[model samples]
Target chain A: MRIVVQEAPFDFAAEAQGFSRGLSGMGAVVTFSGLVRDDDGRLAAMEIEHYPGMTEKAIRAIAEEAQARWSLGDLLVIHRHGLLAPGETIMMVATAARHRAEAFEAAEFLMDYLKSRAPFWKKELTADGAEWVAAKDEDEAALDRW
Target chain B: MDVLYFAWVRERIGLPKERVETSAATVRELVDELRAREARYEAAFADLSALRVAVDQDLADFDAPLAGVRELAFFPPMTGG
Candidate 1:
């Protein structure tokens, strides 16, 4: 398992390729990337704030839980912090497993947990002003499905 | 113990982190002590429903004990992805 928390943008294609390569028994690989959305072109940028020490620990615990619940061969998580413009990549998650079911389920599980459990917060910037993004009830409800 | 705040909590409290010395037995009591310090803290902690707490970097409730905890954090519900 590999987890990265960085401020610089990552090369998603390269990272995905690297994660999928050299797999011995893994037959399926699932990858997901989150991008900043500019709704109606009002969004200027997104400022992300995170707790340094706790961010890594929280993600690791979530990843460990995914490993325990699924038959994943490997997993990769990369999340970005700091100011990001619209259409920029925010984060990505990948899971490799012996079968597609386990890989897909584990990936979804990781996303659900990361959305609510991670110690990162996002503030959206627009021409008018900046405002903190509120956590949606649906996002919290999504965890119950797992 | 070190007390940390994030997001609007930090903005409202006017600092990211601070070292706090207290004899509060629970997270709720610690919050009360902080709230008694200044209006900013009181305003930031006015709505408990909108806040979340972490003790020693792990998610916990307001009733969680702070006996041996060296780190405590308070913030709004995480908006990460």
Candidate 2:
């Protein structure tokens, strides 16, 4: 299991490639990527904020929970903070397993937890002003089904 | 005590960090103490609605004691993904 919380954007291809180590048991790899959205290029960017120490702890815990929920071989989770322009990579999760079922489920679970449980917050810089994004009810309810 | 702020809570208080010395035993008490200190803290913690606290990097409640917690974090609801 691996968890990373950094301000720098991640290279998904590299992360997936690196996850492929000397293990012979793994047969499948599943991944997901989230990108910053653009509204006709009207919105400039996003200023992401997070607790310095608590962010990593929260992420690691989520990854661990995902690991338990699935028979994942190796897990890679990376989330980016700091000012990010639209089209920038926001987050990525990769799961490896001996079969597709476990890898796919675990990858989705990681994203689910990342959506609501992680300690990061985002503010969007729009033409009007800076507005802090509120926690979405849909995101919270999505977790309940899990 | 090492006090940390996260997300919009930091922006509301205009403080990202502070080191305080207090005898408050629990996170809630510390918040009460802080609210008493200044208007900014009071406003930031005014509602405590949609707020969450963490002790030593662990998700905790406002009532959880600060017995062995080295750090306390306050912030609004999370928007992680």
Candidate 3:
């Protein structure tokens, strides 16, 4: 398992390939990437803030839970912080397992937990001003399924 | 103890973190003391439901004890993914 909290943008394709390569007995791999969305085309950039000491700890706990609940070969989580333009990658999660079901389920589980549990906050910047993005009720509700 | 703020809480309070000396026994009591300090703190902590708290870097409720906690953080619900 690997967890990365960084401000520098990551090369998704390279990271994905690196995560899946040279794995023995792992028959399936699942990957998910989140991107900044400019829904109204008014978004100038997104400013991400996170608790330096707590962010890594929280994400590691979530990843460890995923590992315990699923039969897997490996998992990877990479989250970026700081300013980012629309369409840029925000984060990515990858899970490798002996079968697709476990891989996919673990990936989704990681996402759901990371959405509401992590300490990162996002602020949307536009021409008019900036507004903090609110957490959705649906996002919290999504945790109940697991 | 160290008190930290994030997102709008930091903006409203006008600082990211500060050293706090207090005899508060719980998170709620600490918040009350902070609210009494200044109007900016009052405004930042106006709605308890709109904020979340962490004790020593772990999420906790306002009613949680702060007996041995060295760090406390207040922020809005996380929007991470």
Q: Candidate 1, A137: how far from true, in Å?
A: 0.5
lDDT over C-alpha atoms for residue A87 of model 2: 93
After TM-score superposition, the amount by which residue B44's alpha carbon in candidate 1 deviates from its true location, in angstroms, is 0.4
What are the per-residue Cα lDDT tens digits for candidate 2 across A1-146?
77888888878888878887765789998988888887667788998888776788889888888878888888888899999999999988888999998898888777878878788888889888898889888888888877
Output the TM-score of candidate 2. Answer: 0.92
lDDT of each: 0.96, 0.85, 0.97
Task: Give me the TM-scores for chain A across all models, comma-separated.
Answer: 0.99, 0.93, 0.99
TM-score of each: 0.99, 0.92, 0.99
Stretches off by above 4 angstroms in model 1 are none
Docking class of 2: medium
lDDT score, candidate 2, position B14:
92
Residue pairs with colliding backbones in model 1 are none
lDDT of 1 by residue, A1-146 (tens): 99999999999999999999998899999999999998889999999999998999999999999999998999999999999999999999999999999999999999999999999999999999999999999999999998
The lDDT ranking, best first, is 3, 1, 2
For model 3 chain B, the run of ten residues with the poorest summed lDDT: B64-73
Q: What is the C-alpha RMSD of each candidate to the true structure, in Å?
A: 0.7, 1.7, 0.6
